[model samples]
Target: MDAKVMNQILEIAFEKRVSDVHFEVDNPPFFRGRGQLIRSKLPKLKPEDTEFIAKTILEANKRQLDPSLREQDASYSLPNGGRFRVSIFRQKGVIGIVMRVIPPHIGSFEELNLPVVLSEIVKAPNGLILVTGPTGNGKSTTLASMLRYLNENYSYNIITIEDPIEFLFTSSKSCIIQREVGIDTEGFGAALKAALRMDPDVIMVGEMRDPETIDACIKAAETGHLVFSTLHTQSASSTINRLIGNFPPEVQEVMRQRLADMLVAIVSLRLVKDKSGENIIPVVEVMRSTTTIQACIRDGRLDEIEKHIENGVAQYGMQTLDQHLIQLCQQKIIAVDEAKRITRSMDLERKLMFTS
Candidate 1:
């Protein structure tokens, strides 16, 4: 397959710092930058153009475009060190593609404007740590930052099982091994299970997508390996509930008990525009496994988790999303209107403004 046209499109995306590039039949190419989609001035793509792009991308990655399958996900790296997570699918019986840019360098926690508490989360010796958020919300980037921290500071065998392996980590003080899901191993669950035998001191699972993967991650943590993973939940409480809810009703109680014992912390992130509206900043909700938090999880008092996070900000280094938003607003890192849109709690906003 000829990839010249696709390469040109990707090079443009790289230069513009575009977060995503979209190609669809009958629609002009578009770039999603700073949370907005901007259409290219170029004319709409023809069906053949999209088909050629799709085939070229798949061929470049040594993947096949199976018409029988409605969708496919892959990742490709450019010769100039740019990488993208590509999703190609059939829409209206025509090919369409979405490519997300992955930065070549992994930013530090401070560089990413992540909370300082994240440093503590990455330093833990062993337990399950989760970064939870919806897709395109910087969840993978946050986890990558943590792994990079460990790589730079400690000497351990770190194994990461990713679908397409987003960040490429160079060995600093650690022996880092990255395995792609379909390339290096069979899948997340199988790779995780094999990682246990690989003598990994730290393990990063790209995502906990199913019960088997979740159970394997918990077991790996229980067996004295520091495990980090991501989930598609909006809040700390929701992340916990989602994990336990993945199991059958009969096994949920058991899972909860295990989670209470083996869980370390949960960090939920949302990226909103900074004060200039030109960049995104993360508003985070952190929940550490204190004695009280452990009890709440074991006893199924999930509703109280948020309150604990609110009250424990000063003592436990836990912060609710509202608390973080308030801090950002007070520091002029984000405008009040933007903060209000994110928090979506006028009463809480008033309390934050009036308190102190």
Candidate 2:
């Protein structure tokens, strides 16, 4: 709870390249490194320790982490030039905190090892571009890289509505305005609607959490503003279904049509260690909105989308998850068994076998 102790814990986490630090009662602090939970070599923390750390972070950020209410999400900046996104909540009626380490430097697309096609996608004049995956899979980092690329390459007014603003971007060739949900404006929907009136050329919604935010993002894209957002889905088809599922059954069909019109691309990613198990690389599934893909969405033929992604890889710059895994395996970036574990398609399994 003390600043000195917190700094020490953070130093250890940073030095070990841990993604997250967790504190809970009756448990020693844990570090999530390379997607594995590693217990800290320290004594178990008491309830009071977690409570103190939670309150300390909240107070320093000038926010409240009231367990009686809902959980709190906030950002914290360390004195030694580190930033963290902190989630404080009640678990088993005790205080608990999870701090995700946000990298200070936003990496370029090449540095993040994203595909070259992403550079072309990010330069779209207007429409919705989604970078999706489950939690802790570098979705935010990927989105940040795209935005950073735009910031460096183009001259546009970019406005971002983030729950807790993660990567801080100074003005480059583009004019950037970042609004934190609680601190900058009322909420995501409000900030997004207001951003539209602000004449923004590019809008970044941190996460399309609810129907309201999703609707707002779609409308923003429809209005000719290049929009970027994230979803917690595994594949492009599932991402479309998840978006339409947010609306009522009666409106889902209409929403699907609207999404089909405005959708630009969907990139789903997963981070897996390389063959040596030393470095993590992203295996991506990309689905660009081509005429065939749009028809599938409009006709509600979601199941047919994957085949299109596979066949249209060369034509549309789209690739399925299995395709990416196969490439990684062929390149020896990942082992054959690792690719098999990550992929689900028998078709792709046979392809991997034959290719290997």
Candidate 3:
């Protein structure tokens, strides 16, 4: 409960320009800087000290960090305007905490260097839009930017279900309602089930972690709510397959139908090292659900969906990861070798590198 300790942690997070801060017993705290991670020079924390810090995070948020206290998590803001989604848990019987720094204000598409399609995604009237990527790939940031765009441009009520709410939104052109997983509702599934009853025009789910959550999200979309969520997948097709695969075999057919009906677009993305080596830029593969894509999902020809993504241009706003990477390379936003290193298509990467 020491203000000085909390201030020091915030200072450390800001000084490193880190998106996250990690603290674990017996190990010195470390922060994830721009593109790399570095250990904090502060002395290693004791168990009691770690607990105190984690508890402080909980107290600051005024949310039950965790029900059982075996592991704890909370979202809180520093006095200086930075926010954090902090997770505290026991690993190897020692307390460990990770504080993901949330910027004071949301970054615009231009500032984040995201694609123009993102602006279009925010303006969608109905259906679901998914942002797909790995951890630390700025998926949350991308989602937040879209939500902020909607806020600034439209008058819609937005409800969010997040485990530890990341970016904070103040009403712009819309009224926003954010619900934390444990604090606001029992869980994502329960919160999503309740969200529909609230009559929201837009629903933002933090992550689709389970079938129940996905089911509720789909239902929300079906009933005409614009749904936005994230998934940990490598490609737009993978994101679709993962969604259908989340359901049981017996019900997958039904779920696929529901998904096809409500699906709008999937933006599978990753952060590749920039040419300047000072930052990372986002590369995305977009898949807009068309009639053929829907038929592919229904007929179990998910593989063919990739070809549609590779070729579809005027029909829908879509592109393949390899192509997106190539554009980034041509634009001098990212290096060819770096794109090749992170690219999933080895053959395509080779061709890209040679041509460029």
Between candidates 1 and 2, name the one with more favorable lDDT: 2
Model 1, 246-337: lDDT tens per residue?
A: 99999998999999999999999999998898998899989999999999999999999989888998888999888888888888889878
lDDT of 3 by residue, 42-149 (tens): 788888777778777777767544535677667877777777887788877767888888877789989988777778766778899999999988899999988889
Q: What is the Cα-based lDDT of residue 208 in candidate 1?
A: 96
Clashes of 1: 0
TM-score of each: 0.97, 0.97, 0.94
Q: Positional deviation of 234 in candidate 3, in angstroms?
A: 1.4
Model 1's alpha-carbon lDDT is 0.89
Native-to-model Cα distance after best TM-score fit, residue 197 in candidate 2, in Å: 1.4
State which candidate has the highest lDDT: 2
Error of 3 at 72 (Å): 3.4
